[model samples]
Target: MKNIRNFCIIAHIDHGKSTLADRLLEYTKTIKITEGQMLDDMDLERERGITIKSHAIQMEYTYNGEKYILNLIDTPGHVDFSYEVSRSIAACEGALLVVDASQGVQAQTISNLYMALEHDLEIIPVMNKCDMDSAMPDEVEDEIIDLLGCKREDIIRASGKTGMGVEDILKAVVERIPCPTGDENAPLQALIFDSVFNSFRGIIAYFKVENGVIRTGDHVKFFNTGKEYDADEVGVLKMDMVPRKELRTGDVGYIISGIKSSREVKVGDTITHVDRPCAEAIAGFEEVKPMVFAGLYPIEADDYENLRASLEKLQLNDASLTFQPESSLALGFGFRCGFLGLLHMEIIQERLDREFDMSVITTVPNVSYMVYDKQGGVQEVHNPGGMPDPTLIDRIEEPYIDASIITTTDYIGPIMTLCLGKRGELVRQDYISGNRVELHYKMPLGEIVIDFYDKLKSISKGYASFDYHQAGFRPSKLVKLDILLNGESVDALSTLTHFDNAYDLGRKMCEKLKELIPRQQFEIAIQAAIGSKIIARETIKAVRKDVTAKCYGGDVSRKRKLLEKQKRGKKRMKQIGTVEVPQKAFLAVLKLD
Candidate 1:
């Protein structure tokens, strides 16, 4: 029990967290180096060079003839998967705060550090990528010490790529990070930080035993769901699955029952022995809530079942993902899916396309809105089409986020201008280093949901990094801007925008749509409206035919008759012709500058 050490690697994207994990595995001789970076099991992760999911492995090492059980969990660095990092932190007692020696501190680095602090975990600062030519170890060490208030000597300098100082990092973990302590005699209590579904074995729950013991054949129950099942198998995580007879207190392992459904065992749920159940559930085990919502429709309506199956299988691994059956008048039958952020949504869409072989059309992303009706009722709206009538709504509230952006001082003006345009309130700003600045703002989540990060990167020339978390809802003068094509409202093109910017946004959207929408036989009127009031409109002139071109040496009256007939035909077509809006037209509004 004294030799057990549980920790997780927390770092920003491309900070060498996964590489460091590989080096640690190699140093511990847990798995042969010939196997390569085995911890990143997902092919998508390997291709993208980003850890999309949190992974855990149990390794054993020997120092001074003393064997230590070192359990390390690797967390995703993107802001979208911060919840995974939080859950990983909850399962461990310490964290290896990995920072790039070249990049110094980044937006996600600060965001992840705060989360580790919130969990009260002991942080072991490690500077990685020291082999690079641009490495600035001394400056990065100062940044870490300043941010964490740790001693200079406490920071570990290591190169994950060249395997330099890897042994020292392992030794520091065993010495500085405390071992897990729990009572084996107490009731069985394990935290299900992650879970996945299996066809043959059913649900496999990965957990850290907080107290007591769990073994194969024991009857275990989920505290939140109150579902009981016999533990058919138990094991600790290695490079692969290895069965164990029992998992005692302070141990990280997996439990498998006959339960086939993934919904039965939820992440953040507590598992305990049915006979010796704990008096109360463990604290701080709230389920993750998605922050972004988007509609996904199958290109072929018949593939809806396949899409549904894919989502269900994906949900087994992604507990933060939520979805329900929904239909859009323009998009047909589809599922309204909820995600942590844009990256999460993108990853899910990619997986659906690659793994499931399904092509899907995604609507514009939106954040949940709280609508207060004049009848003293409140409703949550995830889609712009679901918003109540303007007359019945007293006020609307939208989700706000505390956004932190870190960049070079040169881009301050552009960053500030972009933030203000997004309705961001400048809360604070400070210099993290001689040349780096950290700008804090409170901005609507909706504004940030679409192209804000892209624009920020463009303005800063890719120097700025961004991180944000929900800051709850705030009252805002928001109105739904609906796009009308030839006097018909297109639900998929509707969006919620602040009243102040509605007119300008509507005008821009109309212009963009006009450019993307092809000209038809009749004139097409592209209009943007708030309720019944049209705020902006653009006209696409009808395609005309030269009926008088065939007239050869005709009298003036004959030419005039042919020209008049053509004009009348065009007027008739304009009165009755319906515009054929292509899919690109619907997506064009999403790319409005």
Candidate 2:
């Protein structure tokens, strides 16, 4: 254990975390470099050019004529996948804080840095992309010094593309980061930081052993689930799972117990010997809090059970996703799913389609709210349809967030305008270094959950980085806006909006739906209403059959009779016709400007 080092790579999105990881793997000769971003093996990850999952691999390096075992966990840098970074941090003793040479310290860089510090992990700062034309290593070096308080020489300037300074990074990992420390004689105590489902192998759990030894064929139990199973196999992860006789203290490896169900395993659970268990489960395991909520209904009602099964298996891989059974008046049986943010929600939908072959309809996304009744009873509402009658409610409070935006000084005006338009209150502002400024705002989570980040990037010319956390709720003038099709309320199309935005939001919803919902045989009236009052309305003209066409060149009275008969027929058809809201109509709300 004294010759082992466990560390992870941390940085902002697209800041070369995976590229740097590739260079490290190549330098260690762990595997042949056949493709770029070998760590991001998923099709979606490569297609989107983002890392959706954290990958861990073991490598052996020689330094000063001594062989050292190194385990590197490459982490995702996007804010939506921050939970993955936290889990990776829990399994390692050190982190490589990579900052792009051009785009110094970003919002996610600082946020992830704080997470590492909270875990007391040794941090080694590395300036990547040093070979780029716009590389500003010295300026970024100063920025890193200001943020981390580390000396200039402590930072290693490297280029993942050219493999420049890659050797120095490995040397720093050995010299600066401390070795994994624990007692091997103690009872078995291993933390299951991550796990994945395998079709033939059942479920494979990857863990880090903190104490004692785990041998193949040993009986083990997960503390969280309190379930026991036989360890069918145990081994170290090196690109491929390498079978081992036993895994001792300070070792990262995978265990296969022939578990058949995904529900049997939980991430962050403790693994202990069934005969000689540890004192207690590992403490300080953080639960993920979902920030945005939306309805996910299978396109076919019979697919409900299949959808649930897929979600359960997907949750095994992604612990951040949460869902509960729910039924919508328009969409039939479905689940009300909670996500981290807009991007997280989109990724979940795409994964369901690509990974599970499940077709689903996602309703308008919103944040949870607190509703207090006249009797002083408080209830939390995730869907607008579950809200109590407004007459019996005392007040409604919506979720808010403390938003931080890091950008150059030039885009401050447009950024402020965008925030103010969303009813954001300025909390404070400070200068980080040079022309870079950090602005903090207290904004409603509902306001920014949709397209605020996209707008921020657009206005800042892709230079602004944003991050936020939920703040406590405060009472506000809120009303539930219900969308009615042909005068019948559609529960799946309703949403809760602040009173000041109710009319405008209602009108926008009406206008957007008009363009997405296909026109029916009879005229369809789309109305947005709050209780008994209609706030906005739109009409989709029917494909008129023109009963008068046959009466052309006929007597005036005959044409009038034909038109009146057609009008009566239309009125009768409107009463019995039901509107089918296409999936595009449900998704159009997300793109509302």
Candidate 3:
């Protein structure tokens, strides 16, 4: 226990967290240098050049002739996976706070720093990519000291690419971070931070042994679910899985209990020995709740079963992902899936396409709204199709977010304008450095759920970063903006918007749809309406045909007869024809300028 140091690396996206982890693995000889960054084994992660999940590995290092067992938990940097980072932090005693020398402190960096502080972890501020010509180590150091209140000499500067200060980082972990505290002789208790399903071994749970020892053949029971299983194997994670006889206190490893279903072992669940259970379950364990909801439908109706099977397989490793069978009048059968954020939703869609070879369509994302009826009953509506009648709903409340944006001073005016346009309330603004500022706002989650991030990036010329968390629900005058094609409402195109901007937003959406939908034989009326009142309208005229030229020097009566027949056919078609709305029209609302 005295020679063990458990820590994780946290940083913003594009920072060198994974690269630094690779260097540490090579310096300790945990894996061959030629093997590269083996921790990020997923193909999606490699393809995107980002970490989507937290990974753990065990390493042995010798410092001053003392052997230390170092457990390194490498966490993702995206704001979408902040929950994963928090769980990783909970399983460690210290954190290596990595910051890019060129980018300095970003929105996600500040969010992650506060999370580490909340866990009371010892943070070793490390400045990475210091060898670049554009590196501003001095300015970044000042920023770190100002934010963390650390000593000037305590910060470690390193370059993951050249491995300039990798050895010193390892040494700092040994001397500065405290070892985990637990009694091996006490009742067996472990915290499950993550889990993955294997076809051969069944459910494999990655956990941290908080107290006592767990070995093969021990009966373990989950504290929350009250389900028991016999441990089939116990092991530590090197570059690969290495089976061990047992796992003891202060150790991070995986356990296989012959459990076949991934749903049986949930992340954040406590495990204890069946015969000698712990007196109380571990605190701070809560199930992950999704923030964004969207409908995912297979492009072809015959592929619905294929999409269902793919989702079930993907959910084995992602405990936060939730879905259920839902059908739409316009979209047919599909699943209404819930995700942590937009990135989470996009990653899942990409995985479904890449892994399962399935093509799917996604609807506009929405947030859960609380609807209070005239009878004083409150109901939560996850889908707009499930909303009660407008007259039945006395008042509606929508989810709000506490948003933080970090950007240069030059883009402040445009950023503020963008936020205010989205119904954002300015809470506060602070200057973190000479040119960088942090703007805080309380905005509706629905506003940011669409194209708010894209607009922010555009206005700031891709220099701004954003992070947000749910701030509960608030009363708002929101109305449903319904889109109509040829006098028929398209349910999939309906969205909730603030009452003040409904008319203008409706106008833009109608105009955008006009550009996306193809012209038909009859005039197509694209309209946006709130209740029975039409707020905006656009018309696509029918394409004209050269009936007279086709006559070819015929008599005037012949030309008139052909034209009369064409006109009659068009009028008849208008009475019986249905306009086929293109998929692009459904998504055009997101591109509204």
Candidate 4:
């Protein structure tokens, strides 16, 4: 048990957390059971090079005649999934903090490091990407000593991409990371970090045995909710894409106790003994909430049932997601869905396209808001469709975000100017480890709810990285604008905007919508309005010339030919009447740049 070590590989986005895990898997011979194998079992995880889900693996190795078991957890680097990262940190006794030798420390790295420290876990600093030409190990080491307050010799340098210094990093984990310290004789208790589904094997819950022995056939209970179940089987984390057998205390593993669905297995929930459970559950646990939302539906109304069923299946695996039936005057029927961030929204869209083989139309994304009415009524609105009457709104409050940008000083002026244009207030600036500087800004969630990251990257020539966190809500005058085409409000073109910029935004957004919409047989007048007042207008010219299928008098069949041509024209006219706007066109306006 003393030889067992549990640690998570922590880093910023694109800082090589997954790549380092791959190298560690090879070094520890975890994938040796198969030939030409990939360490990450999930296809999506490998393609993105970022860990979308936290997964643990068990591997054994021998050094100087002593065997050690390494339980490694790979965590997501992006800020949207910070909840998942916190769970991973709690499950481990220590962390391998991976910082890019070239890029040095970043905003997300600081965020994740603070989380690790809050867990009171031992930290083993590791510098990755040392093989790159831009690698600056000396400066990064100094930053670790300066910012993290670590000794000069504490940093372990390596490259997870090329498998350099990986074996040495593993050795450091065994030497520096402490073994599991909880009492093994106490009642069975484990903290659930992640869970997955098995068609034939039911639900598999991955957890850390924080206290006591966890054996097969022991009855378990969730401490807070008092929900009970039987632990039919206990097992260690394996890379086989299947369940293995009996994991003991001082080990991070999985258990399949007849949990038929992942719904019962919530992350951060405590699994404890049924008769003699732990006295208290872990504190400071909060459920993950979806921040932004949009309506998603299939074009064909017949696919409505299929779409709903598909979303339900996906939600069974991810409880953090929320969705419900939403009907539109234009779309007829659809579902409104909520997501954590832009990346989460994109991932869900891709999955719907690939897994369900369905065509979906998603509306422009919008953040949730708290609206106060003149009658002293308060309501929370997640979608513009649910917004209250404009006349009744007394005050509108929107979310604010604390944004940090890491960029070279050469592009500071341009980036600052861009932020100002987006209504961002500069908070502070400081010099980071590498010649890169960190600029802090307090910006409205609406400003960055669009293309802030894209503009930052473009201005900084892809060298700038941006990350943001919720900084609470502030009172503001906000309004929703409805774009109309030929006196009919297009459900797809409805969006939120500030009262100050509402007119300008409406004009630009309407123009972009018109550019995306094709010309019709009848001229379409695109207009933006607040309530009954029109603010801006653009005209989409009618098609001057259309397809003409003419036929000459052809003896007896001439009349029949004319009838066939008339039928073809009728079909074309019907197709033109039901012109459903595409999702890409609605999303284009949000791109701004």
Best by TM-score: 2
**Alpha-carbon local distance difference test for all models:** 0.89, 0.93, 0.89, 0.80
For model 2, the superposed segments whose C-alpha errors exceed 4 Å read: 552-554
TM-score for all models, in order of appearance:
0.93, 0.99, 0.94, 0.90
Please, what are the lDDT tens digits per residue for candidate 1 over residues 1-593? 89999999999898999989999998888888775457777788988889998999988999889999999999999888988888898899999999999989899988898988887788999999999999999999989988999999998889988999899898999998888888889888899898877778877999999999898999989998999999999999997889999998899999888887666877888999888899887787567889899999998899999899889888978888999999988778999999998889989989898878988888888999999999899999999999987889999999999999999999999899999989999999999977999999999999988788889989998779999877899999998999898888988888888999899989998988888888887788899999999989999987877778877895889999988888888888777876766766655666777
Choose 3 or 4, whichever is better by TM-score.
3
- Give per-residue CA lDDT, model 3, range 356-440, as digits (tens): 8997878878889999999999999888888898999899999999999999999999999999988999999999997999999
TM-score of 4: 0.90
Candidate 3: residue 392 Cα off by (Å): 2.0
Tell me, what's the RMSD of every candidate?
2.6, 1.1, 2.3, 4.6
Residue 70 local lDDT, model 1: 97
Candidate 4 lDDT tens digits, 486-558: 7788866688888888998888977887888887665667899988999999997667442333544457577
RMSD score of candidate 2 (Å): 1.1
Lowest lDDT sum, 10 consecutive residues, model 3, at: 582-591
**Tens-digit lDDT track of model 2 for 360-437:** 999989899999999999999999999998899999998888989999999999999999999999999999989999
lDDT score, candidate 2, position 507? 98
Poorly placed runs, candidate 4 (over 4 Å): 33-37, 224-226, 241-245, 316-319, 544-578
Q: Itemize residue pairs with steric clashes in candidate 2.
A: none
Error of 2 at 335 (Å): 0.7
Please rank every candidate by lDDT, starting with the best: 2, 3, 1, 4
Model 1 misplaced regions, further than 4 Å: 33-37, 518-522, 540-580
